[model samples]
Target: MRRFKHLFFLLLVITLVPMTSCDDDDDDVEPSRMDLLTAGEWSGFAIFVNGADVTDFLASDEDEPIDVRTWKLKFNNDGTYTIRGDGVDPSPLQGEWEFTNNEQAIILEGDSPGDTQTVEINKLTSSELFLNMTLEDEDSGTSIDGEIRFRR
Candidate 1:
Protein backbone atom coordinates (compact mmCIF):
# COMPACT_ATOMS: atom_id res chain seq x y z
CA MET A 1 0.00 0.00 0.00
CA ARG A 2 2.84 2.41 0.86
CA ARG A 3 4.56 1.81 -2.48
CA PHE A 4 1.33 2.28 -4.41
CA LYS A 5 0.67 5.60 -2.70
CA HIS A 6 4.17 6.87 -3.58
CA LEU A 7 3.70 5.93 -7.24
CA PHE A 8 0.40 7.79 -7.44
CA PHE A 9 1.99 10.89 -5.89
CA LEU A 10 4.87 10.70 -8.38
CA LEU A 11 2.48 10.47 -11.32
CA LEU A 12 0.53 13.51 -10.10
CA VAL A 13 3.71 15.57 -9.85
CA ILE A 14 4.77 14.61 -13.35
CA THR A 15 1.44 15.68 -14.79
CA LEU A 16 1.47 19.02 -12.98
CA VAL A 17 5.11 19.79 -13.85
CA PRO A 18 4.46 20.03 -17.58
CA MET A 19 1.43 22.26 -17.11
CA THR A 20 3.37 24.68 -14.94
CA SER A 21 6.18 24.82 -17.48
CA CYS A 22 3.74 25.55 -20.26
CA ASP A 23 2.25 28.44 -18.33
CA ASP A 24 5.70 29.97 -17.89
CA ASP A 25 6.40 29.68 -21.61
CA ASP A 26 3.16 31.39 -22.45
CA ASP A 27 3.98 34.31 -20.18
CA ASP A 28 7.22 34.91 -22.02
CA VAL A 29 5.69 34.77 -25.48
CA GLU A 30 4.60 37.96 -27.22
CA PRO A 31 1.09 38.56 -28.53
CA SER A 32 0.65 37.42 -32.14
CA ARG A 33 -1.52 40.38 -33.14
CA MET A 34 0.95 42.93 -31.81
CA ASP A 35 3.61 41.77 -34.22
CA LEU A 36 1.41 42.24 -37.26
CA LEU A 37 1.38 46.02 -37.58
CA THR A 38 4.16 48.56 -37.81
CA ALA A 39 3.08 51.80 -36.17
CA GLY A 40 3.72 54.86 -38.31
CA GLU A 41 2.27 57.47 -40.61
CA TRP A 42 1.69 55.62 -43.91
CA SER A 43 0.97 58.17 -46.67
CA GLY A 44 1.10 57.83 -50.45
CA PHE A 45 -0.52 58.67 -53.78
CA ALA A 46 -3.53 56.75 -55.00
CA ILE A 47 -5.37 56.15 -58.26
CA PHE A 48 -9.08 56.69 -58.72
CA VAL A 49 -11.58 54.00 -59.76
CA ASN A 50 -8.94 51.32 -60.20
CA GLY A 51 -6.99 53.38 -62.69
CA ALA A 52 -3.29 52.72 -63.28
CA ASP A 53 -1.97 56.27 -63.10
CA VAL A 54 -1.76 58.84 -60.30
CA THR A 55 -4.16 61.71 -60.96
CA ASP A 56 -3.91 65.31 -59.87
CA PHE A 57 -6.29 64.92 -56.95
CA LEU A 58 -3.96 66.53 -54.50
CA ALA A 59 -2.49 69.05 -56.91
CA SER A 60 -2.67 72.69 -55.87
CA ASP A 61 -2.91 74.00 -59.41
CA GLU A 62 -6.15 75.85 -60.09
CA ASP A 63 -6.24 74.45 -63.61
CA GLU A 64 -6.73 70.90 -62.36
CA PRO A 65 -10.31 69.83 -61.87
CA ILE A 66 -11.17 68.88 -58.30
CA ASP A 67 -11.46 65.15 -58.19
CA VAL A 68 -13.38 64.44 -55.01
CA ARG A 69 -12.76 60.73 -55.36
CA THR A 70 -9.19 60.74 -54.09
CA TRP A 71 -8.33 59.92 -50.47
CA LYS A 72 -5.41 60.48 -48.16
CA LEU A 73 -4.97 58.20 -45.18
CA LYS A 74 -2.94 58.89 -42.07
CA PHE A 75 -2.29 55.92 -39.82
CA ASN A 76 -1.11 56.96 -36.40
CA ASN A 77 0.99 55.08 -33.88
CA ASP A 78 -1.93 55.01 -31.49
CA GLY A 79 -3.92 52.54 -33.55
CA THR A 80 -6.12 55.25 -35.08
CA TYR A 81 -6.39 56.51 -38.65
CA THR A 82 -7.99 59.40 -40.52
CA ILE A 83 -9.26 59.11 -44.07
CA ARG A 84 -9.86 62.31 -45.97
CA GLY A 85 -11.62 62.35 -49.33
CA ASP A 86 -14.47 63.84 -51.27
CA GLY A 87 -15.77 60.62 -52.73
CA VAL A 88 -18.03 59.61 -49.87
CA ASP A 89 -20.08 62.68 -49.08
CA PRO A 90 -19.36 64.78 -45.96
CA SER A 91 -15.66 64.14 -46.70
CA PRO A 92 -13.01 63.08 -44.14
CA LEU A 93 -13.77 59.82 -42.40
CA GLN A 94 -12.25 59.12 -39.00
CA GLY A 95 -11.67 55.53 -37.92
CA GLU A 96 -9.44 52.92 -36.38
CA TRP A 97 -7.54 50.41 -38.49
CA GLU A 98 -5.66 47.21 -37.84
CA PHE A 99 -3.86 44.54 -39.81
CA THR A 100 -5.49 41.16 -40.10
CA ASN A 101 -3.87 38.01 -38.74
CA ASN A 102 -1.92 37.42 -41.96
CA GLU A 103 -0.70 41.05 -42.05
CA GLN A 104 -1.69 41.27 -45.71
CA ALA A 105 -5.03 42.99 -45.18
CA ILE A 106 -6.41 45.87 -43.14
CA ILE A 107 -9.75 46.20 -41.38
CA LEU A 108 -11.12 49.66 -40.77
CA GLU A 109 -13.88 50.62 -38.35
CA GLY A 110 -15.38 53.98 -39.10
CA ASP A 111 -16.84 56.20 -36.42
CA SER A 112 -20.47 57.10 -35.85
CA PRO A 113 -22.69 57.14 -38.94
CA GLY A 114 -19.90 55.61 -41.04
CA ASP A 115 -19.83 52.15 -42.47
CA THR A 116 -16.94 49.79 -41.91
CA GLN A 117 -14.93 48.46 -44.84
CA THR A 118 -12.11 46.00 -45.27
CA VAL A 119 -9.31 47.01 -47.60
CA GLU A 120 -6.60 44.92 -49.16
CA ILE A 121 -3.19 46.51 -48.83
CA ASN A 122 -1.64 45.70 -52.17
CA LYS A 123 1.57 47.68 -51.89
CA LEU A 124 3.24 49.73 -49.19
CA THR A 125 6.27 51.95 -49.02
CA SER A 126 7.68 54.85 -47.06
CA SER A 127 6.45 57.34 -49.60
CA GLU A 128 3.94 55.30 -51.59
CA LEU A 129 0.93 53.16 -50.75
CA PHE A 130 -1.66 51.31 -52.82
CA LEU A 131 -4.86 49.52 -51.95
CA ASN A 132 -8.18 48.40 -53.40
CA MET A 133 -11.72 48.52 -52.09
CA THR A 134 -15.03 47.16 -53.34
CA LEU A 135 -17.88 49.54 -52.67
CA GLU A 136 -21.32 48.06 -52.51
CA ASP A 137 -24.38 50.00 -53.59
CA GLU A 138 -27.00 49.51 -50.94
CA ASP A 139 -29.99 50.25 -53.11
CA SER A 140 -28.94 48.26 -56.18
CA GLY A 141 -26.84 45.56 -54.45
CA THR A 142 -24.11 46.20 -57.02
CA SER A 143 -20.43 46.25 -56.24
CA ILE A 144 -17.93 48.67 -57.75
CA ASP A 145 -14.18 48.16 -57.72
CA GLY A 146 -12.03 51.08 -56.66
CA GLU A 147 -8.32 51.74 -56.16
CA ILE A 148 -6.43 54.32 -54.16
CA ARG A 149 -2.76 55.35 -53.92
CA PHE A 150 -1.08 57.78 -51.59
CA ARG A 151 2.31 59.54 -51.65
CA ARG A 152 3.97 61.15 -48.62
Candidate 2:
Protein backbone atom coordinates (compact mmCIF):
# COMPACT_ATOMS: atom_id res chain seq x y z
CA MET A 1 0.00 0.00 0.00
CA ARG A 2 2.85 2.40 0.78
CA ARG A 3 4.57 1.83 -2.59
CA PHE A 4 1.27 2.22 -4.42
CA LYS A 5 0.64 5.63 -2.74
CA HIS A 6 4.15 6.86 -3.61
CA LEU A 7 3.76 5.90 -7.28
CA PHE A 8 0.41 7.68 -7.46
CA PHE A 9 1.92 10.88 -5.99
CA LEU A 10 4.80 10.82 -8.45
CA LEU A 11 2.42 10.42 -11.41
CA LEU A 12 0.28 13.24 -10.21
CA VAL A 13 3.29 15.56 -9.86
CA ILE A 14 4.55 14.66 -13.33
CA THR A 15 1.16 15.41 -14.86
CA LEU A 16 0.86 18.79 -13.16
CA VAL A 17 4.50 19.93 -13.48
CA PRO A 18 4.23 20.56 -17.20
CA MET A 19 0.83 22.17 -16.82
CA THR A 20 2.25 24.82 -14.44
CA SER A 21 5.57 25.38 -16.20
CA CYS A 22 6.52 28.98 -17.05
CA ASP A 23 5.69 29.86 -20.62
CA ASP A 24 7.41 32.81 -22.34
CA ASP A 25 4.24 33.50 -24.26
CA ASP A 26 2.08 33.79 -21.13
CA ASP A 27 1.80 37.53 -21.61
CA ASP A 28 1.87 37.56 -25.40
CA VAL A 29 -1.77 37.72 -26.25
CA GLU A 30 -2.76 37.94 -29.93
CA PRO A 31 -4.06 41.33 -30.98
CA SER A 32 -7.80 41.78 -30.95
CA ARG A 33 -9.86 43.13 -33.89
CA MET A 34 -10.02 46.54 -32.31
CA ASP A 35 -6.33 46.51 -31.51
CA LEU A 36 -5.36 46.21 -35.16
CA LEU A 37 -7.69 49.01 -36.19
CA THR A 38 -6.47 51.66 -33.74
CA ALA A 39 -2.84 51.04 -34.53
CA GLY A 40 -2.39 53.73 -37.19
CA GLU A 41 -3.74 56.57 -39.31
CA TRP A 42 -5.17 55.73 -42.73
CA SER A 43 -5.19 58.13 -45.64
CA GLY A 44 -7.56 57.89 -48.53
CA PHE A 45 -5.63 56.62 -51.50
CA ALA A 46 -8.29 55.99 -54.09
CA ILE A 47 -11.91 55.26 -54.83
CA PHE A 48 -13.35 53.15 -57.61
CA VAL A 49 -16.95 52.68 -58.61
CA ASN A 50 -18.11 50.14 -61.16
CA GLY A 51 -14.53 49.72 -62.26
CA ALA A 52 -14.42 53.47 -62.87
CA ASP A 53 -12.19 55.97 -61.12
CA VAL A 54 -14.25 58.28 -58.97
CA THR A 55 -11.55 59.79 -56.85
CA ASP A 56 -12.19 63.08 -58.59
CA PHE A 57 -15.97 62.84 -58.59
CA LEU A 58 -16.17 65.02 -55.53
CA ALA A 59 -13.92 67.57 -57.19
CA SER A 60 -16.26 68.30 -60.08
CA ASP A 61 -17.80 71.30 -58.36
CA GLU A 62 -14.65 72.84 -56.91
CA ASP A 63 -12.51 75.15 -59.00
CA GLU A 64 -9.46 73.74 -57.28
CA PRO A 65 -10.42 70.99 -54.90
CA ILE A 66 -8.35 70.68 -51.79
CA ASP A 67 -5.89 67.88 -52.28
CA VAL A 68 -7.67 64.65 -51.31
CA ARG A 69 -4.38 63.22 -50.21
CA THR A 70 -4.83 64.96 -46.89
CA TRP A 71 -7.92 62.94 -46.04
CA LYS A 72 -7.27 60.81 -42.99
CA LEU A 73 -9.05 58.31 -40.83
CA LYS A 74 -8.18 57.42 -37.28
CA PHE A 75 -9.76 54.57 -35.42
CA ASN A 76 -9.89 55.01 -31.67
CA ASN A 77 -9.48 52.17 -29.22
CA ASP A 78 -12.73 53.09 -27.55
CA GLY A 79 -14.95 51.74 -30.32
CA THR A 80 -15.00 55.13 -32.00
CA TYR A 81 -13.63 56.58 -35.23
CA THR A 82 -12.84 59.92 -36.87
CA ILE A 83 -12.29 60.97 -40.46
CA ARG A 84 -11.07 64.39 -41.45
CA GLY A 85 -10.75 65.70 -44.96
CA ASP A 86 -12.01 68.19 -47.55
CA GLY A 87 -15.30 66.39 -48.17
CA VAL A 88 -16.14 65.06 -44.74
CA ASP A 89 -18.65 67.42 -43.18
CA PRO A 90 -17.73 68.77 -39.75
CA SER A 91 -14.11 68.05 -40.70
CA PRO A 92 -13.96 64.95 -38.61
CA LEU A 93 -16.69 62.38 -39.11
CA GLN A 94 -16.75 61.23 -35.53
CA GLY A 95 -18.69 58.15 -34.66
CA GLU A 96 -18.56 54.47 -33.83
CA TRP A 97 -17.07 51.66 -35.90
CA GLU A 98 -16.94 47.91 -35.53
CA PHE A 99 -15.94 44.65 -37.16
CA THR A 100 -18.47 41.95 -37.74
CA ASN A 101 -18.62 38.39 -39.11
CA ASN A 102 -15.50 37.27 -37.33
CA GLU A 103 -13.87 40.52 -38.37
CA GLN A 104 -14.38 39.94 -42.05
CA ALA A 105 -16.63 43.02 -42.38
CA ILE A 106 -16.45 46.59 -41.14
CA ILE A 107 -19.34 48.91 -40.38
CA LEU A 108 -19.06 52.60 -39.69
CA GLU A 109 -21.90 54.48 -38.07
CA GLY A 110 -21.48 58.20 -37.88
CA ASP A 111 -23.91 61.07 -37.50
CA SER A 112 -27.28 60.43 -39.17
CA PRO A 113 -26.77 56.73 -38.72
CA GLY A 114 -29.00 55.08 -41.26
CA ASP A 115 -29.03 51.41 -42.19
CA THR A 116 -25.61 50.15 -41.30
CA GLN A 117 -23.69 49.30 -44.44
CA THR A 118 -21.53 46.23 -43.98
CA VAL A 119 -18.39 46.83 -46.01
CA GLU A 120 -16.38 43.80 -46.95
CA ILE A 121 -12.76 43.95 -45.88
CA ASN A 122 -10.71 43.15 -48.93
CA LYS A 123 -7.41 43.69 -47.24
CA LEU A 124 -6.49 44.75 -43.73
CA THR A 125 -2.86 45.09 -42.81
CA SER A 126 -0.61 47.27 -40.74
CA SER A 127 0.09 49.58 -43.65
CA GLU A 128 -3.09 49.32 -45.70
CA LEU A 129 -6.85 48.91 -45.47
CA PHE A 130 -8.92 48.00 -48.50
CA LEU A 131 -12.69 47.74 -48.41
CA ASN A 132 -15.49 46.94 -50.86
CA MET A 133 -19.06 48.11 -50.69
CA THR A 134 -22.11 48.02 -52.94
CA LEU A 135 -24.28 51.06 -53.34
CA GLU A 136 -27.45 51.30 -55.36
CA ASP A 137 -28.13 54.33 -57.50
CA GLU A 138 -31.40 55.73 -56.19
CA ASP A 139 -32.62 56.93 -59.55
CA SER A 140 -31.72 53.85 -61.53
CA GLY A 141 -32.16 51.37 -58.72
CA THR A 142 -29.14 49.65 -60.14
CA SER A 143 -26.43 48.11 -57.99
CA ILE A 144 -23.08 49.81 -58.20
CA ASP A 145 -19.82 48.21 -57.23
CA GLY A 146 -17.53 50.40 -55.17
CA GLU A 147 -14.17 50.12 -53.54
CA ILE A 148 -12.40 52.29 -51.01
CA ARG A 149 -8.66 52.00 -50.70
CA PHE A 150 -6.62 53.46 -47.89
CA ARG A 151 -3.04 53.48 -46.79
CA ARG A 152 -1.32 53.99 -43.48
Candidate 3:
Protein backbone atom coordinates (compact mmCIF):
# COMPACT_ATOMS: atom_id res chain seq x y z
CA MET A 1 0.00 0.00 0.00
CA ARG A 2 2.86 2.38 0.83
CA ARG A 3 4.63 1.76 -2.48
CA PHE A 4 1.40 2.21 -4.38
CA LYS A 5 0.79 5.54 -2.62
CA HIS A 6 4.27 6.78 -3.56
CA LEU A 7 3.77 5.87 -7.21
CA PHE A 8 0.40 7.60 -7.33
CA PHE A 9 1.81 10.76 -5.76
CA LEU A 10 4.66 10.89 -8.25
CA LEU A 11 2.26 10.47 -11.17
CA LEU A 12 0.01 13.16 -9.85
CA VAL A 13 2.91 15.57 -9.55
CA ILE A 14 4.12 14.84 -13.06
CA THR A 15 0.70 15.47 -14.54
CA LEU A 16 0.01 18.65 -12.62
CA VAL A 17 3.51 20.06 -13.18
CA PRO A 18 3.01 20.40 -16.95
CA MET A 19 -0.45 21.82 -16.48
CA THR A 20 0.86 24.52 -14.16
CA SER A 21 3.85 25.33 -16.38
CA CYS A 22 1.77 25.80 -19.50
CA ASP A 23 1.29 29.42 -20.45
CA ASP A 24 -2.26 30.63 -20.15
CA ASP A 25 -1.70 33.88 -21.97
CA ASP A 26 -1.23 32.31 -25.37
CA ASP A 27 -3.41 34.96 -27.01
CA ASP A 28 -0.99 37.78 -26.26
CA VAL A 29 -0.02 38.74 -29.76
CA GLU A 30 2.88 40.96 -30.73
CA PRO A 31 2.15 44.22 -32.51
CA SER A 32 2.84 44.42 -36.25
CA ARG A 33 4.33 47.26 -38.33
CA MET A 34 0.91 48.66 -39.09
CA ASP A 35 0.18 48.82 -35.42
CA LEU A 36 3.36 50.78 -34.81
CA LEU A 37 2.74 53.21 -37.64
CA THR A 38 -0.81 53.94 -36.61
CA ALA A 39 -0.08 54.14 -32.92
CA GLY A 40 0.54 57.86 -32.75
CA GLU A 41 1.10 61.13 -34.59
CA TRP A 42 4.49 61.91 -36.11
CA SER A 43 6.17 65.29 -36.37
CA GLY A 44 8.73 66.28 -38.96
CA PHE A 45 11.97 67.59 -37.52
CA ALA A 46 14.31 67.59 -40.49
CA ILE A 47 14.25 67.53 -44.26
CA PHE A 48 17.10 67.09 -46.69
CA VAL A 49 16.99 67.85 -50.38
CA ASN A 50 19.86 66.59 -52.51
CA GLY A 51 21.97 66.18 -49.34
CA ALA A 52 21.27 69.71 -48.20
CA ASP A 53 19.21 70.88 -45.25
CA VAL A 54 16.10 72.46 -46.67
CA THR A 55 13.90 72.31 -43.61
CA ASP A 56 13.89 76.02 -42.88
CA PHE A 57 13.45 76.96 -46.48
CA LEU A 58 10.35 74.84 -46.97
CA ALA A 59 7.95 77.25 -45.30
CA SER A 60 10.19 80.23 -44.79
CA ASP A 61 9.62 83.79 -45.89
CA GLU A 62 12.27 86.18 -47.18
CA ASP A 63 12.61 87.80 -43.76
CA GLU A 64 11.46 85.19 -41.25
CA PRO A 65 12.54 81.54 -41.13
CA ILE A 66 9.68 79.10 -40.95
CA ASP A 67 10.34 75.84 -39.18
CA VAL A 68 9.27 72.47 -40.52
CA ARG A 69 9.30 71.06 -37.04
CA THR A 70 5.63 71.90 -36.74
CA TRP A 71 4.69 69.49 -39.48
CA LYS A 72 2.42 66.71 -38.28
CA LEU A 73 1.43 63.41 -39.87
CA LYS A 74 -1.08 61.00 -38.46
CA PHE A 75 -1.57 57.58 -39.99
CA ASN A 76 -4.73 55.63 -39.55
CA ASN A 77 -5.06 51.89 -39.45
CA ASP A 78 -7.47 52.00 -42.39
CA GLY A 79 -4.80 53.14 -44.88
CA THR A 80 -5.49 56.83 -44.53
CA TYR A 81 -3.29 59.68 -43.36
CA THR A 82 -3.36 63.41 -42.86
CA ILE A 83 -0.66 66.06 -42.99
CA ARG A 84 -1.06 69.37 -41.30
CA GLY A 85 1.26 72.33 -40.67
CA ASP A 86 2.21 75.70 -42.01
CA GLY A 87 5.51 74.73 -43.58
CA VAL A 88 4.71 71.24 -44.67
CA ASP A 89 4.28 70.62 -48.38
CA PRO A 90 0.77 69.70 -49.37
CA SER A 91 -0.14 71.27 -46.11
CA PRO A 92 -3.55 70.24 -44.82
CA LEU A 93 -3.29 67.37 -47.21
CA GLN A 94 -5.50 64.37 -46.91
CA GLY A 95 -4.43 61.16 -48.54
CA GLU A 96 -4.57 57.42 -48.63
CA TRP A 97 -1.40 55.45 -47.98
CA GLU A 98 -0.43 51.86 -48.57
CA PHE A 99 2.60 49.81 -47.63
CA THR A 100 4.60 48.13 -50.33
CA ASN A 101 7.84 46.26 -50.90
CA ASN A 102 7.11 44.14 -47.88
CA GLU A 103 6.45 47.29 -45.87
CA GLN A 104 9.81 48.81 -46.75
CA ALA A 105 8.12 51.53 -48.74
CA ILE A 106 4.95 53.59 -48.62
CA ILE A 107 2.94 54.96 -51.51
CA LEU A 108 0.86 58.03 -50.89
CA GLU A 109 -1.98 59.07 -53.14
CA GLY A 110 -3.71 62.37 -52.84
CA ASP A 111 -6.89 63.74 -54.37
CA SER A 112 -5.15 64.57 -57.63
CA PRO A 113 -3.70 62.00 -59.99
CA GLY A 114 -0.32 63.74 -60.03
CA ASP A 115 -0.07 63.72 -56.24
CA THR A 116 1.30 60.23 -56.04
CA GLN A 117 4.57 59.81 -54.18
CA THR A 118 6.62 56.85 -53.07
CA VAL A 119 8.92 56.91 -50.08
CA GLU A 120 11.42 54.30 -49.01
CA ILE A 121 11.55 53.73 -45.32
CA ASN A 122 15.10 53.92 -44.02
CA LYS A 123 14.20 53.30 -40.41
CA LEU A 124 11.07 52.96 -38.33
CA THR A 125 10.87 52.65 -34.59
CA SER A 126 8.57 53.60 -31.78
CA SER A 127 10.20 56.98 -31.47
CA GLU A 128 11.75 57.85 -34.81
CA LEU A 129 11.09 57.43 -38.53
CA PHE A 130 13.36 58.16 -41.48
CA LEU A 131 12.13 58.17 -45.06
CA ASN A 132 13.91 58.70 -48.37
CA MET A 133 12.25 59.51 -51.63
CA THR A 134 12.97 60.77 -55.12
CA LEU A 135 10.98 63.59 -56.62
CA GLU A 136 10.86 63.69 -60.40
CA ASP A 137 9.64 66.52 -62.55
CA GLU A 138 7.34 65.14 -65.21
CA ASP A 139 8.12 67.81 -67.76
CA SER A 140 11.91 67.90 -67.38
CA GLY A 141 12.44 64.31 -66.17
CA THR A 142 14.75 65.74 -63.50
CA SER A 143 14.96 63.65 -60.38
CA ILE A 144 15.85 64.98 -56.94
CA ASP A 145 16.44 62.89 -53.87
CA GLY A 146 15.03 63.88 -50.54
CA GLU A 147 15.11 62.63 -46.99
CA ILE A 148 12.69 63.39 -44.21
CA ARG A 149 13.01 62.61 -40.52
CA PHE A 150 10.17 62.39 -38.06
CA ARG A 151 9.62 61.68 -34.40
CA ARG A 152 6.65 60.63 -32.34
RMSD of each: 10.7, 7.3, 4.7
Worst 10 residues of 3 by lDDT: 59-68
lDDT of 3 at 59: 52
What would the TM-score be for candidate 3 when compared with the true structure? 0.69
Each prediction's number of clashing residue pairs = 7, 0, 0
* Residue ranges of candidate 3 with Cα displaced over 4 Å: 1-30, 49-53, 57-66, 135-143
lDDT of candidate 3 over 1-152, digit per residue (tens): 99999999999999999898959699788778798788999998988887788887765756444465887989999999998886445678899999999999999999788889889998888888888987555557898788888999
Candidate 1, residues 31-106, lDDT tens digits: the string is: 3433323434444344566464535643343543335345556776577778665454445777788887487778
Residue pairs with clashing backbones, model 2: none
Better of 2 and 3 by TM-score: 3
Off by over 4 Å in 1: 1-44, 48-70, 138-140
Residue pairs in steric clash, candidate 1? 44-150, 44-151, 45-149, 45-150, 45-151, 46-149, 46-150
Give the least accurate 10-residue stretch of model 1, judged by summed lDDT. Answer: 31-40
RMSD of 1: 10.7
Better of 2 and 3 by lDDT: 3
In model 3, how large is the Cα lDDT of residue 144?
Answer: 79
The estimated TM-scores of all candidates read 0.54, 0.64, 0.69
Clashes of 2: 0
Model 3 alpha-carbon miss at residue 19, Å: 14
lDDT of 2 by residue, 32-79 (tens): 757667898889878787778777774553643533466898988778
Q: Which prediction has more favorable lDDT, 1 or 2?
A: 2
